[model samples]
Target chain A: MNRSTGFAFIAPLLVLMVVAFNLPIIYMLGLAFWDKGRGFTLEHYEGLLEAPVYLRVLGNTLRISLIATIANVAIGYPLAHWMRGLGRRARLIAIALVVLPFWVSILVRTYAWIVVLGNGGLVNRSLQWLGLTDAPVQFLYNELGVTIGMANVLLPFLVLPLFAAMIRIDDRLLQAAASLGAPPRTIFWKVYFPLTLPALAAGTLLVFILCLGFYVTPAVLGGGRVPMISNLLDTLINQIPRWEQASAISTILLIVALVIFAGYRRLDRKASA
Target chain B: MTSTPWSRRLLAAAGIFGLVFLTVPLLIVIPMSFSPARALTFPPPGFSLRWYQALFGDPRWMEAMSTSTIVAVLSSVAALVLGSLAAYGLRRGSFAGRDWAEGNFMSPLIVPTIIVAIALYLSLAKVGLLGSFVGLVAAHTVLNVPLVMMVMGVAVRDFDLRIEQVAWSLGASWSYTVIKVMLPNLAPSVFAAWIFAFIGSFDEVIVTSFIAGKYETVPKKMFNELILEVNPTITAVATLLIAVTVLALAAVTLVLGRAGKLGQTLVER
Candidate 1:
């Protein structure tokens, strides 16, 4: 194909993306910095710093995102490692289990946690039946519920890539270590674990970035008790009509997410290579 | 590594627990949807489809369903056409900024969806298109474009260029060659991409909630209802959504499996 025709093939989408995607984001950034009469100001960011509520929400978002990412790594690493050792049929089933929920609506998954963690729900019922507790434990409308929901929803994001990277590990590498008289533990820790580290780090960053902006899960699972950054932005935009503050916060979040994404890209390239 | 029996058993136990933790919510929801009682008790009093009945009987729910379907169909088709064209160009073209263009096209997937929602909400409201259906469809198309591009980008790259070259040498016009030769070869991938985009738009909640104004898609209504209170009717809706996803996935797997692209599509990226 000629160069012009090649450009022609992409022209329609390029136009659409520029007008709809890029421009909207740039306009939002402009809103963050621009003032109605004064031309430009940092008043919106100043407002965010002045309020304790904004700081609390920022702290909550970071703490929750960190916990969820850690939980994902804990559960996902073992799961992916085990999957690497699975038979073909079993591996396929495991992948399906992980991927199915990923494709489901985030709302549905978040809501299901309510049913499972509610007063009369499964976990509480099981606990009470086992005589571990006299009453149902509070798991909904709190930080605990929010963290668990976020971890569950974001697990596949960590596991899938980690598993893919795991499967690519040549078994001979481990066997060779074993042949060198390294015990199973040493072989796993020294050879296998290190090999998977790049992918693991990449997946961890991806999940953390996702958790930072989580809205629906926190809204439903936390029941307005846990105010993450996204919920704070929602309140600023919709309830109180503070667009400038919301834009300022969103600008910070976008920059933070992009920076972490750049790091993830580097690790991901190394993992795949 | 699998030699140590006790360690292997421990790993297996943890892996099974992880899988259960991941899928138990879905399993619980499906059974709860069929419960005769209103309470979310797992072992129901008896089997009943009352929730499904409620879902289908309510005109509001029906309207939301139709709105979701229309928006999904329109946006997915738009995404498929535009994304496929762009994917073809990005793969075959030697443009100077081709890599940059591809990254820009894929940025929507990387940027936090909440940011996308707020941006669109602000910009659309600024332009007085916030509540418009056109605006809604356009947003969905943009959001889903990355999905279509991912699938079609791989497909276009893997497709042999010599076939198209032969068609061009035989005096077939570019459009004729694409329609007759390229489309037939890429049909499986095209179908898979369309299904992905459709599901993406249909299940969209955050963006739809922000910008849809009074328009209610199923997910939007379901989310609103969940926030206010937990209704058993949503269980039915959740189950239905799961069913649709499973079916769509199965269809994609079957088509792409026949084309021998399933593993590559699923695992490679």
Candidate 2:
């Protein structure tokens, strides 16, 4: 194909991106710095630091995201490792089991948790049936519920990458460690764990970044009581329609995601090299 | 490596627990959908398809489903066209700033959907496109194009363009070469792209929530329903969505597995 023709073919996507993707983010970034009444200022960015509520929400966002990421890793790592140990057919089945939830809508999955963990819901009833507790536990509409829900929602994200990472890990390395007098636990901690760090890093970064932006799970599970950055950004834009504050939060989130993404890319390059 | 007895036990128990943790809630939704009871209860009292009937009967539910289907179809088709073009262009020959150009296209999947939500809202509303079908399709197309490119780009990478050149050398037009040679060769990835874009658009909620305005897709309708009250019909909707997902997954696996790229194909959506 000729140069112009090739460029012409690519032009539609470029034009659409300019209109839909690139311009909107630029506009949002402009809104962050552009004040309607004052024309232009760093007031919104300054306000993020000045206001305790914004700062608190920012802190809450980081804290909750960290917890969610940690939780996902705790759950996903062992599962990925186990799948790695299984036969090929069994591994595929295990993977299918893991990937199944990614098909479910985030809202639906979060809603399902409300059913599973709600007062007088399945977990509560099961507990009652077992005579473990006298009263129904308040699992939903709380941080624990939100954490569980978010972690669960992000599990596939974690496992898929971890599984892929582990798939690349040569068994010979483990054998090398074992033959060199490393015990099973030592082999895992030394050879297995170190080799999987790239995938571990990749999954952690993905899950953490995702958790940082996650809205539905935290919104539904938090029951409006807990606040994450995404929800806070939503409240600023939707309920209060505070465009400046919302833009600031969105910008902060964009920066955080980019930084971590860049960091992960660096790690990935090193791992691959 | 032979694991210690305690280690084996630990792995077995944790594996079982993880699988159950992953699947039990989904399984719970099935029975809840069939329950004759109104409330969200487990071990649902008696089985009935009342929710299914209700879902089918309700115009709002049906409208949402149809609207979602329309958006999903229209957006995916557009995304496939545009994304394939971009993928082909990128793969044709290396260019300066090619990485930068690719980054712009893939940014949607990485950037938070909420950011995309607000961005599309502001940009679309500015041009008098918000809440309209045009606006939603535009936004969804943006969201799904990267998915198409990722899937189709794999095919583009694998299939040598020399055949297309040869076809052109034989007097076949560029369009003709692409249509007759390239497409058939990359059919599996085309199917994969369509499936990803279709399902991605269908399952999209956050961006749609912001830009959808009056056009309520299924997820938006369900979100609204939750805001009012959790209804039995939602379980019905979820069940249907799950069923759709299963079929879609099966189809994708069948196609992409044949291509030996199922692992890469599975993660995008």
In lDDT terms, which candidate is top?
A: 1
Candidate 1 regions exceeding 4 Å error are none
> Any residue pairs clashing in model 1, and if so which?
none
lDDT of 1 at B217: 97
Global lDDT for candidate 1? Answer: 0.94
Q: Which ten residues in a row have the lowest lDDT in candidate 2 chain A?
A: A264-273
The TM-score of candidate 1's chain A against the true chain A comes to 0.99
> Which tens-of-lDDT digit does each residue in A80-192 have in candidate 2?
88888899898878889988888777777877887799776889999999999999988877788888888899999888877877887888988888889889888888778
For model 2, the superposed segments whose C-alpha errors exceed 4 Å read A36-39, A271-273, B267-269
Global lDDT scores for all candidate models: 0.94, 0.84
- Model 1 DockQ, alpha carbons vs. true complex: 0.85
**Number of the top-ranking candidate, with TM-score as the measure:** 1
Candidate 2 lDDT score at position B136: 94
